[model samples]
Target: MFSRAVRPAVRAGSLAVSRTAPSNAANFATLREIEGRLKSIKNIEKITNTMKVIASTRLTRAQKAMEDSRSYGQTSNTVFENAETKAPEDKKTLLVVASSDKGLCGGIHSGLSKATRRILQEHPEADIVVLGEKAKAQLSRTHPNAIVLSFANVCKDIPNFNDAQAIADQIALLPNEYGSIKIIYNKFLNAQSYEAGTVEAYSEEAITQSPNLSAFETDEETLANLREYALANNLYWALAEGHACEISARRNAMEASITWGFGPEPD
Candidate 1:
């Protein structure tokens, strides 16, 4: 009689557990999902933080380079500025788009493409020479025939004097002649802003015909050399400034991406 009583109690306990089993399972599943999401958030934040630091380091170096390069370039062009030399009044010109090979920054390279298109509309006969791959890709789609020369890896790292010199030498070697060369680049104003600007590189004829050329002690040969050197210096300044702008833009972009990632996911 005692054994029969014990059996009824055991049956009641089994029934209670069976009723609550599904409820326990549901709670465990919810907890696991939350844990997975937290792990993902941590990983994503780590990646963004790491990239931001790298870009910040590069930005500092680039800014220093930009300052020094600007000084050197302006010194070289002191002759043109002082002589009041002007570009020829012809529409035919060489447009040297100073962009970079790498990307992932905001609107910098694409902005160059838009500026180039605007210039092309105004000067349809102008020839295009791209100093970096990013602008080349964007321009090729719209103005393939206009591009004569395209360079890659020119802005892979901080630009140097030699890099600019090499590019200037190649431009000099082109068979087609241009009255002037316009170097288009992003002028970094502040961390949050940059504007597209053009720095004119005068041709040999323009340099020689300057109203005040006779004031300088240099001979014709030296003047020719100076023009070439000036082109290289101006290009270096543009490349360095553009690189700095790109790094700053990249840091901002990464931070924004990380913030968006951590936001609540859609159901």
Candidate 2:
């Protein structure tokens, strides 16, 4: 009878051990999960921090270039501004959206698309020429037929005058004559804000139709050349400023991501 009682006690001990074993295993599994999640969050944080640094570096150069281009572009368009030039109401409109190939810069491209759509609503017959893949992709979905031209990698780096000239050359080759060409781009307002705006390039006809055109004496050939030059200048300016806006927006976005817990929260 003592041997039988000792056997029952051993069985009860084994049952108690079995019950505690699962609790220990569960705790270990939870710890492992938390460790993995924390590791992932840390990696994301490092990546975002690196990207923010890069954007900050580029933003400085881009803003400087934007300022320089602003002066150049303003000088080129001075004549038009002085003459109070306007586009003919009866002619077709062409919108050249200034955007970049790369994304991840907040709503930079989307803002352009929205602005384009707004303009399209007012003028359904307007044609579109997209400067970057991002805006092209968005516009293709909504206004495929209206897209007359598209360029990729146009603003991959800091834009130069040559890049703008090449684009203007292509635009000139298009058979359909546009009465007005508007370059739509994100105008940088501040470090954290941007908005879509337009730089207008009037056609030869529109230029001639200006009320003050009679005051400025110019030959037809020279006028044509001036128009081409002005177009390229405006394009370069738009590209530069848009690029700056993108960089600033990207930096802000990365910072916000880390601060606002874009990734999984760490324990």
lDDT, candidate 2, 1-267, per-residue tens: 459769989989989987776544543458889999999999999999999999999999999989988998899788998888999998899999999888777788889999999999998999999999889999999999999999987888898889999999999998898899999998989888999999999898888878887789888997898889989999999999999999898888888888997832111
Q: What TM-score, computed on C-alpha atoms, does each candidate reach?
A: 0.83, 0.87
Best-performing candidate as measured by lDDT: 2
Each candidate's lDDT (Cα)? 0.85, 0.89
Q: How far is candidate 1 from the true structure (C-alpha RMSD, Å)?
A: 6.5
Q: List the residue pairs that clash in candidate 1.
A: none
* Candidate 2 Cα RMSD after full superposition onto the native fold (Å): 4.4
